[model samples]
Structures are given as structure tokens and as C-alpha cells.
Target: MITRVRSELTRYLRTETVGGALLLIAAAVALIWVNSPWGASYQTMVDTSLAIPALHLDLTLADWTKDGLLAIFFFVAGLELKREFVVGELADPRRAALPIIAAVGGVVVPAAIALAVGHGAPGMDNGWAIPVATDIAFALAVLAMTGSRIPVSARVFLLSLAVVDDLLAIILIAVLFTASLSLLWLGAAVACCVAWGLAQKYRLHTPLFYIPVALICWYALHEAGIHPTLAGVALGLLTRVRKDPGERTAPATHLEHVVQPISAGFCVPLFALFASGVPLNTAVLGSLFTDRLALAIVLGLLLGKTIGIFGVSWLAIRLGVAKRPVGLEYRDMFALSVLGAIGFTVSLLVAELALADVGAETIELAKAAVLVTSMAASVLGSALLLRRGRVHQARRDADQLPQGEGSTK
Candidate 1:
């Protein structure tokens, strides 16, 4: 059972690794398209409207990417998180402590730095959450690319920390960003969630039965002005994580396996393509140096995330609340935390929400900052990992040898 779970996780990480590369390609395409002579066409494409007023669904393509497609990504995340809590590492208090602490530090410290740096600056304070997120796909991609010999334990830590960080981001989106609440729609969404849970409880595993309920939940949440992605998280959390010995897989695990590909391959890249096309006008470039928003965001992501996650994790270890995983070292933790600083997917969404009241130019500037900062983090993390990777590879080689094979030889 343990081997099977490990194999499944390895498969999932490989999928995400490939997806990260695709995400980069998609972002590059968007950049080129936006800067190309047909830049107007690129703008038109995202702004294009798709509305079903009868269903209270009136949204641009960009809106659908953020609120609709991104839900799949969150759903997979929710499933992974549920599995960890139910039957995975997080169920072990010792294993769970460090990542949980690191995740909290990663969120709070970056937010503090962002708030402090952007103090009294319009829209800067509001966008504090922008630096609080970690792009799991991109971070894992860099890890995969940079360190073939990296320990499985390190990967586990990354996923765990990311899961907690994502949960925090979800809470922020729900609480801090929500403008108004529609009680009727909110109640409807809750009812749909309850019905979905009951269906799962009764062994109604048919996609036909669950899909409609899920969509209704998503629609209701959207109408309530809450981020519709929460529907995925709610449904995912409701799904059963444990299976009978006679059963092949739990509903939650099965659902995650089915949807993860869709999330990694389709939803995320689509969102990146739409969300990452910031214009490079001279005015924006000139404003970048003058604005506090970009600097605060960049520093928060690049510096604050590393300090927060690594520092808190070290503290946890020192306090005996947690122990370092086998085969990982101090530098490895620092490098991993640096990789965690690459915030893009949720960060971009937050950027949009944060600057809603600001001008279009301000919003664009913020998005540009996210793109720049994510790249910088990626490069810095890869550099750190490149050195760390050699150390780990040598350790692995020594471990793989026969007894006394390489000792003093």
C-alpha cells in the first residue's frame, strides 16, 4: 500500500513537472502575442464576453479562466490535501509540523513585508496577499529540472507546504477579497454542497450525478460574489478519503486522479496564457521604477518567502516540534523555500482582485511584477538547487553502493 501510494505520488509529480514546462511555454506565447502587432487582438480575445444571463453567468474569457477553469486546479489540490490529512504524512504529527509551520511563515511574513513596503501607497496594501502564494507547478518544475537526485522526502515537503499555502490563499480570497455576500445564492451553494456530500456518502459515484451538483455549487458561489473555485475545494474535502480493504480506491483519491490531468494540462496553462499578457508600453516601464507596488511585491516574493519559510522551519526543528527529513540538509531547506517563493497562479488572481479599484495601468503593472518576480525566484532557486543537487547525488551514489564499497577506497 505504501509503495503504491509512493508510485502514485511520483506519477503525479511527473505530470506536474511537464505541466510546468507547458505553463512556461503558454506564458511565453501570451507575452509574444501581447507585444506583437496584433496586440489589440490579444486584448480582444481575453475581454471577449461569454454570458448566460439565465444562469447568472456573465463573464469574459479571462473571468472563466480564473473563476471557472482554475477550479479544477483547486479541486485536485483539495483532494491531495484531504488525502494527506486522512491517510498520508500529515496524519503523522511529527511529519506534519515543519511544513505547516513553514507554510504559515511563508504566508504571514511575505504579507507583512508587502504591507510594510507598500505602506500608504494606493493598492499596495490591498495587494499584500499577492506575495503570499506559491505556484506549486512552477516550483516543482524547477525542482525537477534542477535536481534529478533530490530526495523524495524533499518533494513531499514541497507538496505539503504548498497545500497549506494554497489553503491560506483560499481563505484570503474568501474573506479579504469578497465585496458583498448574496445570502440566497450563498445558501443555494451550501445546499448544493450538502447534496453533493450526501451523494458521495451514498456511493453515488457516477459523474452524471455529481457533475451537475458541482456546477450548481460553482454557479451559486459565483453569484454570491465569492470565488467560485471554493466549490471545488468544498466538494473535494467532502469526498471520502479512506477505502474499504475490498475497495480499489476511495472516492476522493479516484476523483483526484481523474481531474488532476485536466487541471495540470488544460486549466492552469489556459489561465496563465490569459492572465500573463502584460503590455510593455514605455509608460508602464517608466512607472515600474517609480511605483512602490512592484518593488514591494518583488521583494516580498523573492526575499520574504525565503526568510519566512526557512526561518520558521529551522525554528520548528530547534524547538523539537519537528525533525528534518532524512537526506535533506540546511541548504536544501533554504533552496526549497526559495523555490516556494515563485508565486504566479494565485498571485496573479490576487493581483487582479487587489487592484480592481485601481486603474487598468496599475493592474497591468502589478501583473508584470508577478511575472518578473516569479522568473527571478525560479532562476535563484535553480542556482541554489544546482549546487545542492550535486551534494545529494553524491550521497545517493554512496548509499546505493554495496557494503563498504566506497569507504576509504
Candidate 2:
């Protein structure tokens, strides 16, 4: 059994597309089970009490998944982001411009829409940043399930857009969601982060030094009223390997090869189960349509995201600041814009923070709205992409044929 498990793990580690698909499937099953008739039992199992001696820690499974497992996901995300900036497409200014502009426009328009929709409502204004995120795992999962029929350029575009969207989400979380600031703790976190960077400069290949420093950073950031996970990003960037385009075998790739699959295959799937699965009830269903919080989230996700991503992307292409991707027309871009509307994971995370002090009813309502909007976006975007793929293939085939052959025949 152990050997079989190891073999499966090895296979998953080698392919990004396959590993991502499996994780997503696990997440989907978890979601369905969480909302099913047996959901209460599942919730109970997750919420059962447990205590850790010496550490003075006691929390439910769900809480641990959110605060603990999700931190690892964020850390991996930070690592990937750092890697991209150092050696990937983001290293080129011209190639990066379209996604950067699209990300900014994506964020701004959603926030504005949320603010407009949620205006004058108590506590709703603070949640305007909630819908600006793009859940890369879920978005990528959608594309993966649809197979290679989709263009490679579209996938690359989606990835770049998601990366920028993540950066924007982290910024919004820092600037908007923070409750209070502690300069002393913030300073400590910064110093530790700087030390980590220096350690990297000294070619500290061992992972030991980074672990302790990372814990300190996490604690300090927690004390500073910033979410503890932001420290994961900070430490990740500090320890991230910055290489020239051609650098050969290094610790960075080694670590990615070792850690990324584990994080994605295990931590991410667990997070999906824990973070996304919420018990559905009348209150949740009712709030999906009526509550100020739910309404803002739904509108921001469904309407705000589509309009923002498509509108700014179109403007960029038209203004010559960015060229349209080869083989991807405006129609395809619009479909991808709809895919950007799938805001499940981060939306739920933000919902937790936004309604932390509120009743469970409010939180449940917000969750339902997120689920609905995310599902809608995924379905609509997939249909449009599949249709566009057929069209593109037909055009390509037509272009490849010898001129006048059809008329002569």
C-alpha cells in the first residue's frame, strides 16, 4: 500500500496539469460532501475538540486548515511568484504588460462595483476588496478539465493574469483587512526577512535556517495585525532564488521539485475541503439574494470581474500598449474574462475575515454567493472556450490549405 502510494505520488509530482487536476477533484468532492445531508457529520468530525500539549494550542480541523494548511499554499504561491519575476515571462517588460494592466483593471473595477453595490450598508463597505481575487487553482482546474482543445496562448494568458491577480489580492489584504498596526513587530519581521535574504546571498542551501526565521516572521506579522500568512510570502520572496535566464541546476528548482507537488497535492486539496465546505441552510440560501454582503460579492464576482477583465484587456489591445495573443481573438479573450469571475477560494478567505465578528448566518450567506458565482463563471467560460476552439481550428485548417484548391475541386 505504501509503495503504491509512493508511486502515485511520484507520477503526480512530474506533471503540473495532472497533479493540479487530482487536487481539484478532491476539492470538488469535499465541497459536495460538505453541503450534502451528511454534511453535519462531516462538520462535526472536522470541529471535534483536540488539544496540543506544551504548545497551548486547541482548535477545530477547519480552523487549522484555514490558518495552518492555507499558509503553506500561500508560501508556495509566493515561491512561484518570485520564480516568475526572476526568470519567467514576468522578467520581460513587454510580455508582462498586458497581464499587469489586466490585473490592475481587474482589481479596480471589482472593488468599485462592490463599493457601488454595497454603498451605505453597515460593514459592507469594508468588504469591497473581497471580490478582487482570482483563484488560480480553480481557474486552472476548469481549463484542465476541458482538455487540450483550448489554445496554449489562452492558458498562458490565464496564468499570467492569475499571478497578477494574486499579487493584487495580497496587497488588498494588507492595506484593507488589517485591524491595527504594531510597528515594533512589523520591524522585527522586516529585519528577520532581511536576514533571510542575506543568508540566501551567502548560499545557505540548508532549509534549517529558513524554518526558524520563517516562524519568527509569521509570529511577528501575526502580532502586527497583518494576517500571519503574509509572512509566508515575505519569507518566500527573501529566500527565493533569483537567477539569470540561463542558470543551470540549483537549489531553487530542487526545492520546487520537492515541495511544490507536496503542497499542491496534499495541502491545497485539504485546504479546499476545509476552507470551502460549509453547511448549507435556509439562511445561507436567503442571504445569497438579499443580504448586502452576499449581493455585493455576487455582483462583484459575476458582473464586476467580466466587465473589468474584458474591458481593460480590450482597451490595451486597441491602444497598442499590448498586442493580442496569436491565435486568440477578442471573443476568446472575453470568454477568459468570464473565467476570471470564478472567485471561490480567496473569496471565501476574505468572507471569513470580513464577517469574522458577524453571525454565522451572514458568513454562510456570503459563502453561498461565492459558490454560485464561481460555478456560473466556470460553466459559462468553459462553454465559450470550447466553442471558440472549434472556430479557431476551422480557421487554421482553412488557412493551411493550398490557395484555390477548394474552388478548383
Candidate 3:
């Protein structure tokens, strides 16, 4: 049994993409169930009351999934963000320019666009951050379908871009999204996080020591008026692992290996089920487009993502901060830009926060908007990527032809 578990673990670690696909599947299932005849049952199940006698904690299953399970997902995201900044492509300042610039542009533009559409509308301005994220799972899936013909630089560029986008979104949530503050608890949370950081700096050999501290930090932040999700990022950045490929392995990498799967496989999917579930009655949804929530979400994602990512990427290449990816041009990247608009995981989370206390009707419309735009962006972007691959292949084939054999000249 142990051996079988080991084998499965090894396989899953190697194929990280499967975890992402599972997340998508979970989201799809939630969407279907919510819109089905049994939708009320699904809602009831998620909304059922639950309590932990030991901890004196009480929340609906759905809230627990979103606030609790999703924290683990963000924790993993934080680790990935840290890993990238430490040694990945993002580690290099020069190589990082194109993606960073594109990410900046992508985030700002969508936010501005969302703001423009919903300006002066009640509770509308709060949702500007919804469209600024790029779902790594969906982006990677799209890239994989393009085959090996796409240059490695392009893939690296996209990955780096997404990481940067996540970073921005995290900050936005911490700053723009939070409404109140609890200074006393906030200080306690910071202190705990600081102690964790000191442990890493001193090469603390034990990972277990950080767990209790992290829990305290989570609760402290929760009470401190900071969004609890920020705690994940704090812990992730504080944990460092050094990789010594030949002789020894790094502590951070080892921890990440264990943590990443849990985050990707279990935490992220469960979070999606909770966060992304929204029931839609056609009659109700038809009127949603006119609402501030729906319009902000839809336009923010569709317009902000494309212009922000591609526009800045082009400028970066032109300004010589970074070179364009080999065999990929402005047009190819534009397609990838669209793909970045599929903001399933993060968008919904932000939407929940944005629509907080806004009433059930408003939240429903926001969810619908996210659902519609995510689907549209995915389909259109995938088609463009596939088409681009065909064009690239045709060009390659023509180049390989016998000298003067197929030349029109």
C-alpha cells in the first residue's frame, strides 16, 4: 500500500498539469450542479452549518471552503511566487522585463477599464481587480495544446507573466480590497510571520515549528481586518529552500514538493467548488448584464487582460528591455494575451470580496459575469493559439522544401 501511494505521488508530482485540469473539472461540476434542478440541494449542502467544538469555530461549509481551504491554495501560490522570484526566470532582472511589463500593463488596464464601465455605479468601483488575474492552469493548458512548435522562450514568458500577475493581484487584495483594520491583531500576525522568517534565515531545520505559528498568524490576520489569504503569501515567502541538484537537496524545494500537490490537487479544487458556485436562472441572468457587477466583471476580463498583457509586452520588446520570443511575433502573443483573461480561480475570490454585504442578487450577477467571460476568453484564445500553431507549421514546411522546387520565383 505504501509503495502504491509512493508511485502515485511520484506520478502526480511529475504531471503537475493534472492538478490544474482537476481544478477546472471541479469548477465545471459546480457550475452544472448549481444550474441544474438539484441546484437547491447543492446550495443547501454548501450552506449547511458546521462547527468545530475544539476550536469554537463555526461557518457554513461553503465559507469554510472559501476562507479556509482557499488559504491553502494561496499558500501554494505564495510558494510558487517565491520560488520564481528566487531562482526562476523572474529571478533574472533582464529576462523578467517583458513579462513584468506586460503583467503591469495587463493589471492596470483591465482595472481601469472596469472602473470606467462601472464608474459612479454603487458598489461597482470596488471590483476593478477582478479582470487583472491570469489563471495559470488555463494558460498552461492552452500552451500545451500548441505542441513543441512554440518556442521555449514563449512558454517561459507566459509563465513568468502569470506569476507577476498573481503577485499584483495578491497586493491588490491586501490593499484595495480590505475595508477595515484591526491594528492590534495585525501587529500580532506580523510578529508571528516575522519569527517564521527569522527561523528561515537561521536555517531552522524543522518545518513543523512553523505550523503553530502559521495558524496563529492566520487567526490574527483574520481578526486584524486584513484578508486572511494574505497570510498564505507571508508564510510562503518566509520559507526558503536551496536546491543542490548533484549532492544535496534544498529545504525550500523539498517543502514545496510536499505542499504543491496538496494545494493544487485538494485545496484549489475545493476552493473552486465553493468560490465559483453560483446559481443562474435565465430570467435573472438576462438582467444581469445591465448591473454594475456583471458589466464590470465581463468588460474588465475581456478588455483589460488582452490590452494590458499584449500592449506592454510589445512595448518591452520595442524598448529593448527584453527580446521577443523566438518564432513568436506580436500577433502570437496577442492570442496568449486573450488566454490570460480566463480568471476562474482568482476572479471569483475577488468578486466575493467585492460584493460583500451587497446582497445575494448582486453576487449572483458577478458570478455569472465571471463565468461568461471566462468561457468566452478560453474558447476564443484557444482557437487563436491553435490557428497560430497551424500557421507556424505551414511556414516551417515551406522552408524545408527542396531548393527552388516549390519557389514561385
Which one wins on TM-score? 1
- Which of the numbered candidates is closest to the native, going by highest lDDT? 1
How many residue pairs clash per model? 0, 0, 4
For candidate 2, the 10 contiguous residues with the lowest summed lDDT are: 242-251
Model 2 local distance difference test score: 0.77
For model 2, which pairs clash?
A: none
Candidate 3, poorest ten consecutive residues by summed lDDT? 241-250
lDDT of each: 0.88, 0.77, 0.79
State residue 124's C-alpha deviation in candidate 3, in Å.
Answer: 0.9
Can you write out model 1's per-residue Cα lDDT over 9-124, one digit (the tens) per residue?
55663476788988898899999999999999999999999999888678999999999999988988888888998898898988998899999999999999989888888897
Per-residue lDDT of model 2, residues 319-364, tens digit only: 9998777777889888888989988777778887777777666676
Query: What is the TM-score (0 to 1) of candidate 3?
Result: 0.91
TM-score against truth, every candidate: 0.93, 0.89, 0.91
* 1-409 per-residue lDDT for model 3 (tens digits): 9999987975684354676677778888998988888888888988898987676568788777777777776777777778888888778888777788888998999989899888877667677777788887667766775534655666787878887888789898899766789899999999999999898777776658888888889888877878888898888877775554562666667766777777777888888877667776776578567776578778889888998888888887888888776678887899889988988778888888877777777777787888789889888987888887788888888888765585855
**Candidate that beats the other on TM-score, 2 or 3, i.e. the better one:** 3
Model 1 residue runs over 4 Å out of place are: 1-14, 281-286, 398-409
